[model samples]
Target: MNTWRARLLPPALAIVFAAVLCSVVLLVSGANPLATLAEMIAQVARGTTAVDIVNTAGAYYLVAIAAAIGFQMNLLNIGIEGQYKLAACVASIVGGAISLPFGLHAVVIVVVGAVVGAAWSGIAALLKVYRGVSEVISTIMLNMLAIGVVAYLVPTFGELRGNTQGTKIIPDSGQVPGIPFGGAGTMFGLVLLAAAVGVGYAVLIDRTRYGFELRASGLSSTAATAGGVNSKRMVMSAMLISGAVAGLAGLPEILGRDHTFTLNFPTGYGFAGLAIALLGRNHPIGVAFGALLWSFLDKSSLTLDNIGVPKEIVTILQGAIVLSVVVAYELVRRRELAAEQRRVGRALGTAAAPAAAGTGGERA
Candidate 1:
């Protein structure tokens, strides 16, 4: 098979298979799949629904890119959940306390979030590099630690009003303004930040020497070290970059929508990002599509209950898509490996035959 075909076919097939399977399931459960589809389509056609999808997708895009960075380096960095939360907490406090010019204040809050996230992830990186602690284990523990710290500090240092508990509201100078879309919806201005992050991620991973080193390290640490790639530094750098991007995952809500870190601030976005990253195969463009699809499903699911269709069907469909895509990709990878080995074997055989004939002539 052609290399590009091999790369593209699996994902395409996975989507088809998942859709067919979901249709069958819906039919078996006595629901009208076409009606359900129409409902989803009608709901998404609304301007408000479109705006909500874009707004949510912006956050998912940041989270997916963050996970993709670690994934490219073979790191899990499960602490993304904790990293974003902690960064948001600290950034909210700092942003609320200060009153600077609009642009500078926003920049400071973003910087504070990125720095705190990187610092939190650094703990897992150091443990992995120096103490041989598995990042999966360490990051998981760090997540719990982060939550505990946030819980403790919020009550002590954060402000609380009657029936509302959260950090102080950020002043207008620190808030991110929204772009109104014909009064039907207001899009978060931070969507530009998400776009910038995507562009930066693409450039960093595809065009830079450091990206080559990171890819090499992920492919084979021993080989990367043999080539003088400095595996430790690459691992640390990737982790920090991942965490820095993770920090932005919550900023759309914080700076644009919420203006403070409330106890009810969104959670679980990081875990959703992990799934999106997997679905995207860690590619920036792929991640964008994945984020949009995930967001669409989430938004469209809201209308499912109104039509007497189980909303849980969307959850099942999502799970099936992820599982199917993963299996398809793995199969493609193995097939590619086998094809490469066969090509190498044929080349070797042809070369050996020429050398053997030449040796026979000499011996004769």
Candidate 2:
């Protein structure tokens, strides 16, 4: 209960702060901040929008949770961008290739996409574990490389979906098929995916030995090693699992949900995931809510045109929220470190004082 409250406070405060700051900015920009917020809420209530904000939120959740898992292990799988891309490509290509029944085809696409994502991500993990490459640099480079690979493969070999230059749109038989919501844009599949992420991530972090070791290592590498945990293995497993989660995001996006492969269907879900992970404090459950909040903000920002607010204003709001959260986290971390140092220093001082007193007594 206490833990839940503790996790909830930061985001709650951030939202309030963001609201006030946005209001001030809006007032200065000759727009009513209150009106802007109301306009956004009204749009959501009216269910008259070009995009499904909730569904997009689900997409961000998928990516953010995956990246958060990697972050927990002290590994920044910047490769999530590449991981999602490769999974989308591999799954779309392989899934469209098969002509199975509807249910079977959906399953095939999801599984294939996830596996492909993990496989692609494994390259970064392999480099870090074996070749001594930093995941940050490798993942970023690999993301660009994956993009090139996709361009080459799609134009050259062609997917079974009937593509001449790029892969063809997936057939109905291969689609995960979304349930109607509001105006038939939002899907029930999204709800299921969110639940699965929450449950799966929580289990991976709390119920597994790997999670325990990773947490320990994140806290202190030397202590983790002393505890007999194979730090290197933990790091590799962390990367692999993180990659797998990132791979899963592609399922609902390309192969499962869209049944199509476009040049860039993913609108920066990977980058958004990093922000979500940070905001949620890297807790799986917290991250879930964070994804929802981001999705709301992101989708509503488009509606700014209705109230005459510039799009850049919305971006500024997001930047402010991210900056505030980062600052708060750093401050909290510093205080904890300072407290720890004081405790250690006090113990050393006490031990030395007693030793000096004993020496004086013996000399007298």
- Cα deviation of 335 in candidate 2 (Å)? 4.9
List per-candidate RMSD values in Å. 2.1, 4.2
In the range 1-364, model 1's lDDT, one tens digit per residue, is 4767665767677777887888998999999988998998889877699889999999999989999999999999899999999999989989988989978999999999999999999999999999989999999999999999889767766788777678888899999998998846889999989999999999999999988889999999999999999988988999999999998889988899889898888888888899889888888888899899989999988999999999888888788888898898989888888999999999999999999999999999
Model 1 scores a TM of 0.93
TM-score of each: 0.93, 0.86
Name the runs in model 1 displaced over 4 angstroms: 1-3, 345-364
**CA lDDT of 261 in candidate 1?**
91
Q: List the residue pairs that clash in candidate 2.
A: none
Model 2 lDDT per residue over 1-364, tens place: 5455456666766767777788898889899887888877776765534346667777778888888888887888888888887788777777767788877877787778777787888888888889999999999998999889888767554544333344666777877656666573656364577668778888878998877888888888789999998878888778877777788776665643566666656657788889899899888777877888888887777778867789678777777888877776665556666877999999999999999999999999
lDDT of 2: 0.77
The model with the greatest lDDT is 1
**What is the RMSD, in Å, between candidate 1 and the native fold over all Cα?**
2.1
